[model samples]
Target chain A: MAQKVAILGAGLTKFMRRAKETGKELAFEAARMALEEANMDISEIDCVVMATAPDMFDGVHMKGDWLSDGAGAKRKPYMRSYVGGGSGVFAIIHGWYLVASGLFDTCLVVAEEKMSSCMPHPQGAFNAIYDQFLERPLGVNLLWIFSLEMMRYMHVHKISLETIALVSVKNKRNGLDHPCTQKGIAGEYTVKDILNSEVIAYPVYRLMVSPVTDAAAAIVITSEHEAKRRTDNPIWIEGVGWCLDTSYWTNRDLYYPKYVEYAARMAYDMAGIKDPRKEIHVVEPYDPFAYKELHHLEGLLLADKGEAPKLLEKGFWDRDTKDGIPSCPSGGLLGVGNPIAAAGLMKVIEIYLQLKGEAGKRQVKREVKRGLAQAWGDLMQVGTVVILSK
Target chain B: MPFKEFIEKLSKAKVQKGDIPVWHLYTLGIGGDVFYKGLKEGKIKGAYCEYCNSVILPPRMYCEDCFEKIDKFVDVKGPFIVVAYTELYRDLDDNRLDIPIKVALISVPYAKGGIIHFLNPYQEIENGDIVKPVFNKKRVGSLKDIKYFELKK
Candidate 1:
C-alpha cells in the first residue's frame, strides 16, 4: 500500500530573463502564492525542500542556507536537491516522499534560479560542467551538444528542419496566450528562417533553443486526507521516477535517450500504464531544445520510437490540434521560458491546474484524467519523470 | 606625519609571502585510465559496462549501479551524438575567444560514458555523424592532449 500523496496548490512568479526581485524575494512570492492557493499558512508546513540550480547562477555561495528564511524553512527540516534542470521535477518527488512517508503531513517545495546574476557570463559557469582536466582545454562552447543531438534526431528519424522549426514557432505562438511568458514572440517563422538564422552550432540555430531566464515556482503537497479536507479537487501523484546515466556523455548512442526511457518505464509501471500512447491524455516533455521534444516524446513512450516527428508533421502535438494527446499545453520552456529549476515545476503546476479545470486560457480542450511531466539535465544524462492523476 | 608614527604602523603589520603549493595530479577519478591513456596514445578510447551494458566515453572506472570497475577500452568511430550543449559568445573576462569554438557531447558506441570534445573550426559535424579523434600526443596527461575531433568521411 502506498501512502497517498496529492498536490494541494501551486504557484509561480512570472518567468523573465531578468527580474528586479532578489532570489529570496522571488522565492517568497511564489511560496506566498502557493500558501494562498492552498488556503493555508506558512506555519502549517512541516518540512521545506528548496531546489535551485547552481549557486553560481545567482552569484551566491551556499544558496540553500541563504534562501532558508525566504522559503520559510528557518527551523524546519531544510534540504536542497539538484539534478540540474531536473531539479524542479526532483523537488516535487522529494515533497511526495515526505508526505507519503508520513514524516510530514504538509511540505512546501520551492525551486528558483536567477541566471542573470552570473558576472561576465552565465555560459562561463556552464563551462564548469566539462571535464576540468580534459574537455575544458579544447575550447568548447555549449551549442555543440545540442547541434549534435539535433542532427541525430534528424538523421535517425528523417525529421526535416522545417518540422523542427514548427515546434519553436508553435510553442512561441502558444506563449502569446500566457501572461507570464517572457520570450514569447508573435510572428511568422519558417524552417528556412530557422535554418538561415545565425548558426550557433552546426544543425542548431539561435531560435531553436530556450533563453536563460530568472524565475521561481512553488507547490504544496499533503497527505490524501489533508487534500480531501482542503480542496474540491486535488491532483494525486500516481508515480515518479528519476534515472541518471554515466557522466561520460560522449560514449553513448544518444540518437535515443535510454535514461529517459528507463525513467519513464519506471514511472509507467508504477502508474499501471500499459501503453502510454493510449492511456496518457497529456504530456509536458522537457523542451530545452526543439528536437528534444521529439527525442523525449519517444522516451516518454508517448509514441513509437522515431514516430514523434511524423506526428508533429500531422499537427499532432499542437495545443489546439490534439491528436489523441495534448503536449506542452502551457507552452513549455520553449515558449513560456526556461528558468532552469522553475521551468520543470511550472509543467507540474500546469498538470495540476488542468486537472482541476482551473487552467483558464491555457486550458486543454480534452479532459486531462492523467498527465506526464518530465525534465532532463546533467550533461545530457539525467531524466526525471512524473505521472499525475485526478 | 611623524616618522615615529609611520614606523609604529609598519611594525604592527604582519606580512608574509609563501609560494602557492602545486601538485601534478592525474584526474583519474572523474575520467578513467582509458580517457587519459587515449589522449596519450593519439586515439580516442571509451569503455562499455558489462553489467548495465551502457557505453561511456571519457570512460568511467565503475558502473553507475554495480560500482564494478571497468578496465576494457574500445575505440570510437565517431559521428558522436549530442545530448545537450550550449554556445558561449564571450569568455570569462567578457572578451571573445579567437573564434567561436564548437564543443560537443560525443557518444561512442559500446562505451558506458560519453566523451566531450572540441569540433574543428572549419569542419562541420552533425549529430550521429562519424568523427575521428585528433590528438596532440605531446600534450597527453594534460587537458590539451585531445586537440579536437574531425568529421570522418
Candidate 2:
C-alpha cells in the first residue's frame, strides 16, 4: 500500500505584467518562503519538482534545468513536470507520487512562469502549439480557439453573455482581498461593463481574459508521519488525478470538458468522495477565461451539464453565500493573474491555505473540510485535479 | 504490389509549410543587467558567491551550487583561457562559408562559468591559449559589444 502524503506549507509571489526578478529569482523567492513556512531547510528536502509553461515564454531552453537551482534542487533528485497550463496542479500530483511511493520522504514542488519575456505578447507562443501542418497554416491562436469553446458552451446551454459575465464580476471582486492579485483586474465591474468591454475574439471580451503575468508558487509535501511531526495543521493530500485527451481537438466536442470529468472522477474515487457538490466545500477551478470556470465546474461533476450558469445566477457560487459552494475565492486566474503554470499552482495553494484556516479575508462563509483545485490545458485536452482536506 | 500502391498514394499527399512568428524581448534580469552594463564599459563582470568562494561568469542573481542569493559584483579583469574552440564552416542556412569562423569558450580566472564568443580569425588559436577581449568603439550593453578574443600580446 502507498503511504499517505500531506502538504506542510505553501508560498506565492506577487502576480504582475512584468517583474524585475529573473525566472530563477522568482523561483528562489517562492521556494525560500515555502521552506520558511514549513520550518525546514533545503537539506531536509529529499527531492525537488518544478513546473513551468513553454520555454518560449521564459526565453530559455531547458528551463527546468535552468530553474532547478532556484527551486532548491541543487544536488538533490530533481524532476520537471509539464502539461501545458495544467502543470501547476500536476506538480503537486508529481510530488504526491514521490512521497507516497516511498521514493522520497519529503518533496518541494515549485511552479514558475515569466510570460513577459515573450516580446509583443505571450499569445504568440500558443501559435506554435497547434498542429503544424494543419492548424498552424491557418494562423491559429489561443483567443480564437478558446472563444470557439466558450461560444459552443453558451450555445449548447442557452447561457446568456450576462450569465457568463457574472464569473468575471465575482472573481474580480473576490480578488480585491487577495494581496497578490494583479492591479486593475482586482476592481469590481458590472455585467454591463464586461459586455461593453473590447471584444478581442467573438464571445471573448478583454475583461473575460486572464492577463498575461509573471509569478511563481511553491509547496512542500511530505509523508504522513513527517507531516504530522513538522506542522500542527498539515493539509492532507487526499487524492490526485490527471487525464489527457486526444491532441486532435477538432474531433472532440468543445461544449464540455470530458477530460476534466475523467480526472476529477479519478481524484474523487481515490478521496472516497461520492458527492462532490456536498463534500467539497470550496473549489478553485481554472478561470483563465471567465466561461472556463463554469465549464470546469460541470466537468468536475459539481454541477449538472449546462447547470453551472444557473447556479451562479442564484448566488450559489459566491464566497459568503449560505448553502453554496464558494468558487474562485482566491480571485482565480481571471482576477488574480495568469502566469500559465504558476497560475494553476496558485489555485492549489489557495485550497491548501483555505483548508488550514489561514486564508484571512478570502475564507468562505462555511467551514470547509475538503476542497478541490482543477486546472485544464493543452489543446483543451488535459485536466489535472488535486483534492485536499483538513 | 500493395505496398507500392501505398507508397504511390503517399507521394501525392499535400504538404503545408508554415512558421510560428514568435519573438522575444527578454529582460536583462538581476545579474544580467550588471554584466551587460559592465561589458558596455569595456569590462568583464561576475557575481561573487561568498559561500562557494568563487565568482559566477555570465552573472546570476543566485548561486546554483550554494542555492543562496548572490548580490556581490566584481570586475574579472582576466587573461581568459580557451577551454574549447570550434571552427564553423557553414551558415545557419547550411550554405558553405567563404571563410571558416572561429568560436571559443573562454574561461575567466576565479569564475565558475565562461562565455562563448568569436575568436580572432587571423590568430593561431588552440586549447589552453590565454586570450584578451577586444571591445567595439561604440558599445551597446550586449554581447556584441565584445568584438572577439585575441591572443594576449
Candidate 3:
C-alpha cells in the first residue's frame, strides 16, 4: 500500500507589488522558510515540484528549469505543472500524490510568479490567452470575461453591486492582519469606495480586482511516518482532485462552474465529504475576481445554487459571523495579491496556519478539523481542489 | 578607439551593440504563414485537409481531425463577418498610437478557423459586420502586407 501524505511545513515570502528581491531571491527566501519550518535540511528532499503560471510574467522561458536551484531541485526529480491560476495548488496536490505513492519520502513544493517583469503592463501577457482566430480578433481583454461572468452571476442571484463589493472590502480588511499580504488595505472600507473605483470592465471595478503581484510560496510534504517524526501537528492530505473543461469557453455556461463540480465530486468522494457544506470546516475558493469566490462556493457544494451571495449578505462567510463558515480567512487573492501560481499556494498555506492555530489575528474562532482549498484558472476552464485534515 | 574603450562602449550600448546574444519575437510563419501570405495579395486563404475534408481558415498547419499536416493553401474572397474585436487606447509600446486600432476576428465561411486582423474605421465596425481584406501593394507576400480590413457594405 502507498503511504499517506502530510504537509510537514509551509513558508511564504511577503506577497508584494514589487519586491527588491529577484525572482531567484524570492524563491530562495520562501524555500528557506519552508525548509526551516520542516526542521529539515535541503538534502532531505527527494523531489521538487515547481509551479509558476507563465514564462511571460517572469520574462523567462522554462521557468521551472531556470528556477531549479532556488526551488531546491538540483538534479533531483523535478517537473512543472500549469493549469493557469491553479498552478500553485496543483503543485501541492502533485506533491501529495508523490509522497502517497511512495515515490519519494519528502517533496518540496514551490509556487512563484514575478509579474513585475512583464513591462508596460502584465495585461500584455493576457492577450496571449485568447484564440488567435476566434477570440483574439474581438479585442477581448482579461477583465471582460470576469465582468461578463459577474454580470451573469448578479442576474442569476439577484445580487447587488454592494453585496459583491462586500467581498472585496471584507477580504482587504481581513488581509490587514496578514503580514505577507501584498494588497491588504488597512482601515475600514465602504462599498462606495469600490463603486467609485475605475471601471476596468463593466460590473467589475478596479478594487474588486486583485493587484498584479510578485511573490513566492513553498511547502514541504512528507510521507505520513516521516511527517509524524518531523512535526507534532502535520496536516494530512485527505484528498486531491483536478479537472479541465473544454477550451471552447463561449460554448459553456459562464455563471456556473461545471469543472469545479466535477473536481469537487472527485475530491469529496475521496475525502468522505457527503455534505461539503456541513463537513468542511473552512473553505478557500479561488478569488481572482470577487464573483469567482461565490461562483466557486456553489461549485464546491458549500452552498446551494445561487445561494452564496445571500449567504455572504447574511455574514455566513465571515470569520466571526454567527453563520459559522470561515471562508478565505487568510484574506485570499482578493485581499492579498494574485501572483497566479503563488496565490493558490497562499490559500493552501492558510489552511495549514488555521489548522495549526498559527493564523493569529485572522484566525477563525471555530475548531477547524477539516479544511478545503481550491484554485481555478485557464480562461476559467480548470479547477483544482485539495482537502486536508489534522 | 582603444580596445578597452571600444569593448566598454559596445557592452554599454542599449541592445548589446557588439557581443551579446539577442532573439527577436515574431509571430512566426511556421503554422500561420499561408493565412498571412494570402492577405498580402488582398485574398483570404485557408487550408483544407484532403483526408479530413475540413476547410480550416487561419490556414492551420495540421487538421484538427486527422492531426495530419495540411501544407496546401487555398484562396477565398471574403464577406467575412466580424466575430470579435477590441479597440485599444495604447500601442504595443504603451505609448498611444496616432490612430486608434480596431483588432478583430473575421470568421470566413467554409473554413474551420478565422483570421485575426485590424479592422479600420473603428466606430462603424460592429460584430457580424461583413468586411473584406485590403492589401498593401508595397508589402506583398506577408501578413502585414494587408494594410487593414474595411466594412464590405
DockQ per model, Cα: 0.01, 0.58, 0.01
In angstroms, give how far residue A270 of model 3 lies from its true place: 1.1
Residue-by-residue lDDT tens digits, candidate 2, A1-390 = 789999988889999899988898899989988988898888899999999989888668899999998899988899999999999999999999999999999999999999998867899888878899877777678788899999999999999999999999999999999999877878889999999999999899999999999999999999989988977778999988999999989899899999999999999999999899999999999999999999999999999999999999999999998899999999999889999889999999999989988899998989899999999998899999999999
A79-132 per-residue lDDT for model 1 (tens digits): 897898899998998888888898889999998887777756666667667665
The prediction achieving the highest lDDT against the true structure is 2
Q: Where in model 2 is the C-alpha error above 4 Å?
A: B1-5, B93-100
Predicted complex 3: CAPRI docking category: incorrect
Q: After superposition, how far is residue A303 of candidate 2 from its true place, in Å?
A: 1.4
| All candidates in order of lDDT, best leading | 2, 3, 1
Between candidates 2 and 3, the TM-score winner:
2
TM-score of chain A of each: 0.97, 0.99, 0.98
Candidates arranged by TM-score, highest first: 2, 3, 1
Q: Rate the local accuracy (lDDT) of all candidates.
A: 0.78, 0.92, 0.81
| Model 3: per-residue Cα lDDT at residue A177 | 83
The TM-scores that each candidate's chain B achieves against the reference are: 0.67, 0.90, 0.71
Q: Estimate TM-scores for all models.
A: 0.71, 0.94, 0.72
The runs of at least 3 residues in candidate 1 whose Cα sits more than 4 Å from the true structure, single-residue gaps closed, are A183-188, B1-153
lDDT of 2 by residue, B27-129 (tens): 8789889989999999989899998799888888888777678889998888799999999999999999987899999997668999999999888999999
